[model samples]
Target: MEKIISHAISERVEFVLIAGDIYDKEDQSIKAQVQFYKEMKRLEEARIDVFLIHGNHDFLEQERDRLELPKNVHTFSSDVSCVPWQSPTGTKIHFYGFSYDKRHIRENRLGDYRKHGDADFHIALLHGSEETKASEHDVYAPFGLKEMKQKGFDYWALGHIHKREILSSQPGIYYPGNIQGRSKKETGAKGGTIVELSEMGATFSFFETAPVMWEKKQIVLEGKADRTEIYRATDELFQTYRDTLCSYVIDLEIVTEQASKFDADEWLQLFEEMRTESPFVWINTLRFIEKNQAVSDKWYQGQFLADELDASLAELMEDETFF
Candidate 1:
């Protein structure tokens, strides 16, 4: 994160926009604050401003009011508010947002941010879950993508869902995701977006900032005739992926009925010993797949309802793309 912030110095961007969730906790540690202060100080020295809001994870109630922020750092109010920034080129950009007052915000706060300003770029800054049946989120600041797109804003800077996606490009609604992958679940290139404006409208692009990445890889051990062959095949599998571009925190899944043959402790020990053999692979998980564990066709023959559910579960679990 510090490295990326330092990189901003050379980018010559007018300002940095962080939608929300800068810290994991509202009451962030002194070490984190000090580090942030130093980074912001550097940004200020480069004449780069930073505009940000607080997400539910770092709600307003948990803010440290005593710590003085850098002059270049601008924070939004707890209530919905709009701040307009005029570039030296006379282009006006209005940023609208509010921080979470409580831990869970169930209300649809989009109503508060009705884009009424006339500016070269009107961007809505939001930090919450999008309304979709497929999502398992706790419905924080629930909002629909359709309504957001209809608001006539030039862009939507969204947060909380740490998976960079541009849901729409017509008006440019973007989620930059998180700058750092704090856990294995966030597995991919982690970074922010760079948007350029011209007569052609806004052109968006992404940059890589994460020092380390989390990735999942599965090695099939079914064809290995015995434990010795299985061990050899696994080593070959690692060798094949040893050329992975970046340093990786890997969750390795070994798929085969041979899982029962090896002791977990010994397998992990072997993995640890050879982990450094690959330049980039670090085994964060060593899971053994127990192949053919699903119930047989005979078990589902008599019970129709049970068979239907069992079939669905099997499809969900066995489908290679489910994850």
Candidate 2:
């Protein structure tokens, strides 16, 4: 947030838009609210406008006590509405969005968003997932891609998905993604998009704001390679990140046909030893995968004892007398 505020001030952006999920939890702590307020206050002092909405994670609760935001901040209400703002260069812009009133919003609200007014640019903010049964994410305000494209908004600033993606380029539908990664699974350069819009179309670039990044790298070894060779490759991998400015929490996956030769305890000790060498890199996890097999025979014997016991139990049950 500090980086974002600094960037906004430095770039002299007319306004800032936070799609949703400002708070991690619905019942946000006072400390978080105070911290956020301080950041918002900084933007307010710089005379930058902030427009934000609530997502499922931080859905609005009318009964709950809420901290009053700064004067510069404009929050969207439960009902879909369009707020107009004149850009620094005198380009009329209309921002259309709505805040989540409850945790679950099963209804598709995309139809509610319609480009209106004589504004030069129309930007819509939506915190929802693409309507698909295969999606692992919770379906809230589900929308179809075709439905969104047909809306004819100049740009769609989306939220809810932690991974940054440009669903469409022509109309500039984007998911800036979460600025900070909360888990190891959410990897890559985590940040928001700086969109440059015009009467022609929209062009945007992603900026890295995450102080610490989560990354996963896989090291593939030949069947003939020994432990010494494997360790050397791992060391080489860490050396590549020596010039990284921000700290990284990396998960390493070692793939080899000679999985039996690799020892977890030795790798764990090696990780601990190398962790102190670089202040910027911390190896959070180490996993081994067999070359062509799903699970290595040695992995089951050494790591997954529960699976082995289950197999043993199944064998005993074949005797008929073994309950």
The candidate that wins on lDDT is 2
Q: Which candidate is the best by TM-score?
A: 2
Superposed model 2: Cα runs more than 4 Å off: 133-138, 277-279, 292-323
Q: How much is the lDDT of residue 16 in candidate 1?
A: 82
lDDT tens string, model 1, 34-81?
A: 888888889989888888888877777644563667999888878888
Q: What is the TM-score of each predicted model, taking all chains together?
A: 0.83, 0.85
Model 2: lowest-lDDT 10 consecutive positions: 314-323
Instruction: Report the C-alpha lDDT of model 2 over 1-323, residue by residue, as the tens digit.
Output: 88888888989888888999999887799999999999999999998999888998899998989889999999999999999999678889899999999887878899799888898888999998877654433347889999898998998889887879889877888888899888886788987678888667778887889988999888888766787888799889888888887889888888887676678667878777777443578878887777876354445555557676766565444321121
